[model samples]
Target: MNHRCPAVLVHGWRSHPGIWNRLAPVLSDTAVPFWRFDHTAMQGAGTETIALALRDYIRAKREETGYTGPVDIVCHSMGTCIARYLLEVLDGDAREEQVRQLVGIGPPNNGSAMAELFNDPERGPEVIRRLVGVFVPEDYDPGDDTIVQEFRPRSRTIAALRRAGTRDDIAYRILLGANLTATPAFFPVFSGKTWEFAPDGGWRTTYAGDGIVPHSDSLLPGAQVDVFPTDPANLARNPELYCHTILPKNPELVARVRDYLTLSARPAARTPPRS
Candidate 1:
């Protein structure tokens, strides 16, 4: 163990750390400090409530570690939103100073099409689907403030991070995956979107979608995007990574993530070329 600044991993909405069990092994191989949090309760909650819970955990973790240093945060999907909120919205000079980097995969920085649909005015009260909002707890009122962002410029959390102006302190990188690859089954995410299957089994990743999220919404701002090849088996079986196509394990992609993190953290070496 390096015993220095540790790294934390936060999973996205309607998910658990277990979802990344395979990915976690990859991080462990690199000896990076990996942490996971269960935020099933954050679904309907407002920012403040979520922030308070995260702040409490941060303080607790700091005390537990008994170390004074920065910590790296790695997140995926909606979890990216929570981690960003913690780093930026929660008050603390020490935190801003200590954070080494923020790396997110499929973070939906702009917001998910599903979220937009839920927040859509045309949907009205029917927008809040009973089955879909299970992860969101009952306490937090969805009718509160309407910033509608995780960590973008307009988001309260992102605004705070920018105001803190510790750009030199904490760095950010985003890894993007097409929703088609993230989806569990090769199906359209939005209603009324579907593919016309031919008499034969062969089919393409049509305009329909992976299942839950759209491709356009997956690309968030302020982050670099890395496209991963869809799981070959997925193409063969017509099953995507997830409804969002963000979860299917792609080993090649795992290697890429390892490379990106290691390179990002590594000190560049100078070479003396010979004639």
Candidate 2:
């Protein structure tokens, strides 16, 4: 292990490393080397598949960096699920302990009702297929399964992963958006205004959440929760603010994450990527 451990950044579903465009500079300023973990961007790849791939990536990074100790993880959206599985489910006690801190930005830790909208068997799947086209390029094949299919509230995969719960050894910070219409009316309505059946089969009260995930769902039982700032105009109508897609673009949010790493993590030597 090097004198310091590096931080790993994992992007959310249907997203690529480019999403870190804004946060990268902030992390660099902290003097801690960071790496981005990219997946196939196919939500249907399955959570276990993604978690295993992350495990492999972490192992490779460890070997290449010669840092056997735990590293920090910063994940956005569904990426939080994958990181949790890697740390709490797949990794051994010794290896899991190496994870120093985890910061989840707009993470759907519980589950998002939005997924159920498109994952519905009758008409939802088709809407999902069409929606996938809008986000990914034509060449990208999401196959039969989709991330939307997995993210539906009360999905089997999410249930399985939730069994392990968040690790107490790792420090966690969950950042959620509080507004639904901060941008413009034309923007898709992803705010927490929607509600879904809870695990107990009761209807959850609807409130403002990040455009994609409700603030309540974004929360973890033990992790610290920080609501992102809302647009100045929407403050009155929308006390809670921030959209799912814009999590990385917020300067204040990025600075907060950077500050966490700066204070919580020490600088580590750079490691070259494997050829």
Candidate 3:
């Protein structure tokens, strides 16, 4: 009998397992059983706390299934940072378990500029107001959101992640959305561009993002990165569906994720010798 590695699904902050409703079946069809990590109950918990819980959850699943091998992690947004804390910080130092691949969709790998924007003294309120009902809620306070605070560009948690760096043994794949047309329908909040903090402490917008996380925040050294809708025509068709909030259910992204998760399972093709 062949051994199939399990896939762990981690959703971002303020998100639920239902986000995986579309992607799960595709993975299931590939014979990969997915274990969804639901963090909704742990609202207001810090990333470290959630990461520890994640560790415990993975251990319990391993014990239950008696499979002690490597597992692939598929995460989105803040969940990517949480999973990184587990696999690169705690588990990386302890050398306990193994993770074959860390596939992140619209990940805030370098800490989130949106988080920083939300905490800004001058522009914070207006920013929050714009995102309300679309990305956040009415009267949402960044100060009250623990996970948001932790993912800020200057947060201690992000500093720790920078110190730990990525694990050499695990493969990292990043998928980010792009609004090539800069259409308002893509993401009405910021006029279809992602907000980013400049080196000079000023704010700027860029189309190389998913209306939430910019490409600059998602790029990690040694990680394979790909931008979605390689064809601009797709975004031109249904611009709103490619935003950061809806990436998990995006048909293009789901298919790409399925391909990444099942890559190892497929037998490698024979290489022809040079003539």
lDDT of 2 at 233: 55
| lDDT, each prediction | 0.51, 0.66, 0.86
- For model 2, the superposed segments whose C-alpha errors exceed 4 Å read 1-4, 41-43, 92-97, 121-143, 180-207, 230-241, 264-275
Per-residue CA lDDT of model 3 for 1-275, tens digit only, reads: 53667989999999999999999888878888789999999998999999999999999999998888999999989999999999888887887878989999999999999999998999889989988998998889999999999998788999999999999999898888887766777788888888887768899888878888888888889888777776779988988778898999999889888887877423211211111
TM-score of each: 0.63, 0.77, 0.94
- On TM-score, the stronger of 1 and 3 is 3
Candidate 3, run of 10 with poorest lDDT: 266-275
TM-score of 3: 0.94
C-alpha lDDT of candidate 2 relative to the true structure = 0.66
Candidate closest to the true structure, highest lDDT: 3
Better of 1 and 2 by lDDT: 2
Q: Which has the higher TM-score value, candidate number 1 or candidate number 2?
A: 2
lDDT string for model 2 (1-275, tens) is 23445888999887888878888887776577788999955456878788888888888988897777778899988899888877877763556548888989988787766566544456444445544544434544333546756766677767866787777788888776554334433124422343444559654434345545666567777677665553445544434324567676667578777877766523321211111
Collision pairs in model 2: 1-67, 43-147, 70-98, 178-240, 178-241, 179-240, 179-241, 190-211
How would you encode candidate 1's per-residue C-alpha lDDT over 1-275 as one tens digit per residue?
Answer: 47535667677665666766777788787886665666666665655566567656666777887756777767766666666666665644445436777776655554454454444455523535442443244443344523344432345555554465434456676553333333333433333132222237322233333334334444444444554343434444434443343442445455655665565433221111110
Q: Could you tell me how far off, in angstroms, the CA of residue 120 lies in candidate 1 after the best superposition?
A: 3.3
TM-score of 2: 0.77
- Show the colliding residue pairs in model 3: none
Task: Give the local distance difference test score of model 1.
Answer: 0.51
